[model samples]
Target: MQITASTVSLTVDDVAASQRFFTTHLGYAEQAAAEGFASLARDDVAMDIVLLARGTEVLPADQRDQHACGLILAFTTTGIEHEEKRLRAEGVEITMPLREEPWGERLFQVTDPNGVIVQFVEWATPPAAENA
Candidate 1:
């Protein structure tokens, strides 16, 4: 089998809010939308997003009321600092400040209106792997 794309479905308290946040901040365009659901995609990238209102009937009963807690939607891209600065200039709060890890991963985070943590990461040069 072959996989053509990937999508993250988030159950949020407010579908419209998350829809607006992604479209306005992340350049996602709406592929489809309904009363309590939205499918988003970006032309320049393969990232697809689906936002569902909490308690939406499309979800199974046991999971319908659950929110996207402790889930981080991350993207690995170049120009980490520039993106951070650009987002800041757009008035988007940086929930987690940018920092580089010892292993060469530069990253930062921002939260959506529904509390979904979106992280942007840029990997630096890799050091040699140590022997076991």
Candidate 2:
């Protein structure tokens, strides 16, 4: 089967609170919902996160322990400066400020309400120029 898109599923403490934070601050549109779960998407690419109440059935047993997620979700953009400024103005805690990496990518990192780290990046060096 061909995979058109992918999503990172995250277990959250509060469904409504997480949904609101993503909708209000991160600008994600609600795509679907079930009894104790909701899905949000950006630019039509759906995320696999399912938020459940702290004491709900789907909630993990060890709620106090922090979940270790393997990959850091990154979103590419053409306007890194504009996004960084907007996020800072909204009181979003920026873990990593805008900076150019050794690989020549301008990027920043922000943590969501549920502690999910999201990265926004822009390529500074074009592949064509690098190859020349």
Candidate 3:
């Protein structure tokens, strides 16, 4: 199969809220928008996102009422610390403080208006092996 692009569609209670969050803070541009839907894209990233309001008829009848939950939308990035600091200066709340793991992963998280967890991560040097 030849896949040309990737997109993630999120069923949110407030499409505008999530739409604003992505465009204002995350550098995504609005590709399209409507009463209860929005299509977003970033020039630097391969992934695009679509936001749909809960109960919108565009969704399957069984899924229309369901809202996005228990999902972490993460981005692997460089200069994570700088990114974190920049976000803090922009008045964005940091839900998870920056921390580095033993296996060399540094990450932090922020919650969007509609409760989507957006996490940023960067890999660092591996932990040294302990002598037996």
Cα error, candidate 1, residue 53 (Å) = 0.5
TM-score of each: 0.92, 0.77, 0.92
Please, what are the lDDT tens digits per residue for candidate 1 over residues 38-98? 9999987657999999998899999999999988999988888999999999999999999
TM-score of 1: 0.92
- Ten consecutive residues with minimal summed lDDT in candidate 2? 63-72
- Cα lDDT tens digits, model 3, 20-60, are 99999999999999999999999886479999999999899
Pairs that clash in candidate 2? none
Better of 2 and 3 by TM-score: 3
What Cα-based lDDT does every candidate model obtain? 0.92, 0.74, 0.91
How does candidate 2 fare on TM-score? 0.77
Q: With candidate 2 superimposed using the best TM-score fit, by how many Å does residue 62's alpha carbon deviate from the native?
A: 9.9
| Candidate 2: regions farther than 4 A off | 44-70
Off by over 4 Å in 3: 126-132
**lDDT digits (tens) for residues 5-89 of candidate 2:** 6766666666676788788877787888876577877775545455554455555667534352555768877788999999899
Worst 10 residues of 3 by lDDT: 123-132
